[model samples]
Target chain A: MPDATQSMEAIEQPAVIKRGSRFSGYLRAISAMVWKDLTAELRSRELLSAMLVFALLVILIFNFALELDIRTRETVTSGVLWVTFAFAGTLGLNRSMAVERDRGCLDGLLLVPVDRSALYFGKVLGNLIFMLIVEAIILPVYSLLYDVNLFHPGLMAVILLGSVGYVAVGTLLSTMAVQARTRDVLLPILLFPVVLPLLVAALKASNGFLQGFNMEEIWPWVYLLIAYDVIFIAVAFMVFDFVVEE
Target chain B: MTHSSDRRLTPCGVKMIETQRLVKTFGLKPVLRGIDFSVEYGEFVALVGPNGAGKTTFLRILATLSRPSMGEVRVAGHLLPAQATAVRRCLGVVTHQPLLYGDMTVDENLRFYGRMYGVRNLQQRIEDVLEMVGLMALRRDRVRQFSRGMQQRLSIGRAILHDPGILLFDEPYTGLDQEAAAMLDTLLRDVADRGRTVVMTSHDLTRVTDLADRVDILHKGEIAASVRRGEVDLAELPALYFSVTHA
Candidate 1:
């Protein structure tokens, strides 16, 4: 082994110098967390594959069950899409947190010296990305199946807002649930009730956008969605430390 | 090793870790009950106890992984649950679990933790850690494919990656083979020789005697007995352990 003083110096110098600015370190920690999740997901393809396959199955089941004409299809698109997203997003969130808990990686993350909220936001961003990727794939499939233009910018905005709100609350609750024995069933049970208001607003705004209603009509639900997203994100940011703590 | 009569402070007058009247309860049943413990800087104290004696619970509280229900706890001069972030920056912990992403390569796992700790010149640091753990050749391999011993070594590498002032190991040798345990002995000795304060909880009395400068027996959430290495006969440790725990 190297000399004791030399080893100590080698270990302490970097930690001391790296503590220069708190904000940059916090941001770096978050980005590192996000990058770790994405890299692992990319290699395993477990989380996304499960989420995407489940989402496609939900959409396929809905398409066969409701063989609606073009007019009717346009009206129900938002509802169908949101339901598929909600269930699939739940699967993604549960699996993401379960991976951490299973390998004791959650404690590893909690041990990081940065603000714990950084871990929360990092997980939210990662879940949001996964949810969006699934949605991105599902939208075109739904467009082809129903022959509806699901690519409207207004619709996209609603989807982003809804996803942010959903994932913000979902990530926090999933962390709480991951600690339990029945985490798989517990997350959706805990998440759905809490996310109902956000879902309602997203569904309404998405419907308005799909139906080509006036911006004035769509703006109310859009505003509600945005408000829900901001409120939940702030609430999650504040309570995440408590939620993850034992 | 000689016992330090001054239990409150190190030569530098700083207590590395200290807890007073520490209590932890799960719902109604208590795990830790009114425990008081302290370790001076650069001390290697092995906390030994039988199963359900709350050794893990006490170590977790000191590591800031769990909160004390009612007590004053401090590590490296910072209070816990309040100065937890500060405590974390200077603490290195290894539990039974590897706490690594199996899908990622060994290099990736260290890189991830190194970035999380904001270690400077991370590439060089990763190389040094891998070299020290004798896993330099396997750095590119996925961790899931590693043997338990390899994983444990990597876990130690991860814990010491940031070079914290204090280290906590809770049953780190739980699943390792004889060879692995021997390797860990070398690593632990090297870490202790570097003058880092270490508080490890273990069921292995033999290994405890070999690695720790002082041995503390925790029974029913309280410190039952403490002795320096020279104070206790090596062969009689098991008897002392059983008597204290059973009594």
Candidate 2:
């Protein structure tokens, strides 16, 4: 213990305590948070596996129940894909925040000196990555099972845009819900209604791309998706500090 | 006994922590009523109280984990809620929960926190902190595999990783065995010896008497009594605590 005190002095008056500029520090904190989440998930495999399995199950169930012919599958592919993504995304968002809450790591994150929004953005980025990964895997599988081409460029763009909007709002809502005992059920109840506008836009744009509709036909929904993504991201950034505050 | 109005400052005339008329409520129920509290630089003040006395609430507010419903709170000379980021940079907090990631190894946990704090020369600092907490041998082990004592020790390492000037600990000894608690005592002394102001909340009277330079009793959301070391005999602390809290 005496030696501990001696070493403590070394930390107390380091010859040089090099901290990055504020902007760099903020970026570093965000990246660090993302890295922590990714690393933890890599080890546990709990969050991604659950989301992927759930996503696959949803696709399989839709395949059997809808039993769509090729013509009908083309029309319904967008709807089915969006539903699968939304449900899987909700699972990922809920589990991610729950891990933080259960382990008291959320408080640990809040204690950092960076703007609380940095934490919010970091979680958002992490959740977006997980959702994209799940979607990437689900895309080819859904195509195989339903025998429909699901990889149009415009459809990809819609997927990315939709994911951004969904995750941005889901991340914020999950932060709020994680504080509640009924968080598992609370997130979807809060998220689906709030995210409905963006989801509708995504579904429309995706359908237009699949149906080979002209740019003029798809432009409005694309614009709506873009608008919703930006607005939700900005809103989440502004209110995240208040949402996480106890 | 020091009253809330006394406002005792360190020899250098600085209050490391000060709160005036701090009030906190949860929904409709009040947790912390109008209360004033302060700690000087390098002082170790143990806040003892019965359950629901608002000791955790008070420490959480100082740690900036909870917003005081109403108060003028300052830490390390910076007003809180306004300069909270500045205050956070100067504070290291250890609550009852370890606040560590289970899947991450001890080394990775420190590295992650090091990055979050933007601590320079992080590798060397992590090594030093691991050594200080006596967890150097288990650096690569997953935190979930650790015993309760080991996790608490790592929690201390995480708290001190950034070398903050003030530490707020809430029931750090909870769930620790006799040996682990003694080890924590040594660490606490070493920390205080390094000139960091500390405010700790504990239910253990004997341990508080041994480690705290001053003891403040909180009862029903307010300071019921306060006494510096040597002002009261160590043997009578339990009696003092009971009389204050039960009164």
Candidate 3:
């Protein structure tokens, strides 16, 4: 059914496809990054296992280090949980980015035909997934140990907000940190400072909900969390091209 | 002037990477100073330079990993700066590190990159590349466990899995033992035979003399000499390379 001359031309000197016009190319690029990170994680269990073990260990140490009385638990729960998450998030982010840099996979990925934002999303999603898996594992374990049901609807929302915030800034900062001479140690130092807004908002929201605060008491924190997530994600998306550019 | 037609003989029926007056500087030290170069669709061109001659800088520019301070670069007609994303869509890169996740199995790494490159039928492509690299059996093993040579083999597999029309290698064969290097050489030749353009940077002139269709000497941030493969005797090349850089 094909035209003979056109087919011959295709065989002799095939035409290359343009990176599709429209947002579809952007969507495709994003999916490519996400798919790449998730598949790699699924195969190796590298980042997840490391984060999970680290999270559990943090909770265990917190149990001994901090008094478990009801009053102390109420005030410290959100702070304690987010701190653990922040710490664990860095562990996964730094390790993953460092691995990419050390192995020279970053170079290969950069050579791909996609916008650099795709790389940012791919790494962020991968890191977020790893952090969430750790959180999921930690929640039940912490619930059993602390006699608190961490599966509250509000808490889940807070975790999602916190993670989105953490991942957004963490991905961007980690990209920069990985390129520096100080790689592994540099990620947390860099990530924690930029992500304070996300941390504060999520922590406040999480704690307020846990203490059964009124709607008026909780709305401010929730607003802050949403604003933090959206703003940082956008900033991260914009700056990604510069960071990945050689 | 007569040799200009000879330059056109290679099968890169269309140019893969073409640059005009490309300039890049870092920390106020200019690396590529208003340089112009092009690699045809299937041409095997070696960017030969001493340490700090800006070979890597130029390759990075073409790869869209770095931007030039100024100039025009077109990768397969994808106008650079404005259309780097478009240019990146068609190119493939193999660098010194292999750039794979060490904790993941080889299959996972390949599948991830295949998706990143938007390669259709990713599984089939991964299988074909693995088989080509002779790493089909080790697909389940984590890359962290592989030796330096084995890792490089997988790196090559990752780069070629997408079947990019343009393949850029930054000292890809540097760390390999002889047998592995030979395998890499044969694979590169096979890729070239299929009409893929390749631009590689290397320090070893003996190997470059044997492998490159043409060679360009980059010295002190500019191309100092350009020679066809058969023109150079190996003994005189180091002197030429050193003198160019020094000059």
Top-scoring candidate (lDDT): 2
Clashes of each: 0, 0, 8
Per-residue alpha-carbon lDDT of candidate 1 for residues B1-247, written as tens digits (9 for 90 to 100): 3223234223243467889898999999999989888887677889999899999989888878899999899887678889998888888999999999999999999999999998888899999989989999999999999989899999999998988878999998999999999999888877777667889999999888877778899988788988786676755778988999877
- lDDT of the candidates, in the order given: 0.88, 0.88, 0.78
- Which residue pairs show collisions in model 3? A103-B99, A104-B99, A105-B99, A113-B88, A113-B89, A246-B65, B12-B41, B12-B42
lDDT of 2 by residue, A1-246 (tens): 123344334434333245567898889989999999999999999999999999999999999999778899999999999999999999999999988986699999999889999999899899999999999999999989999988788899999999999999999999999998898899999999999999999999999999999999999999999999999999998999999999
Residue B68 C-alpha lDDT in model 1: 90
The deviation in Å at residue B195 for candidate 1 is 1.4
Candidate No. with top DockQ: 1
* Model 3 segments more than 4 A misplaced: A1-32, A42-46, B1-14, B229-239, B242-247
- Answer with 1 or 3, whichever has the higher DockQ: 1
* Per-residue lDDT over A136-167 for candidate 1, one digit per residue giving the tens place of the 0 to 100 score: 99999988887899889988999999999999
Error at A152, model 2, angstroms: 1.2
List the lowest-lDDT window of 10 residues for candidate 3 chain B: B1-10
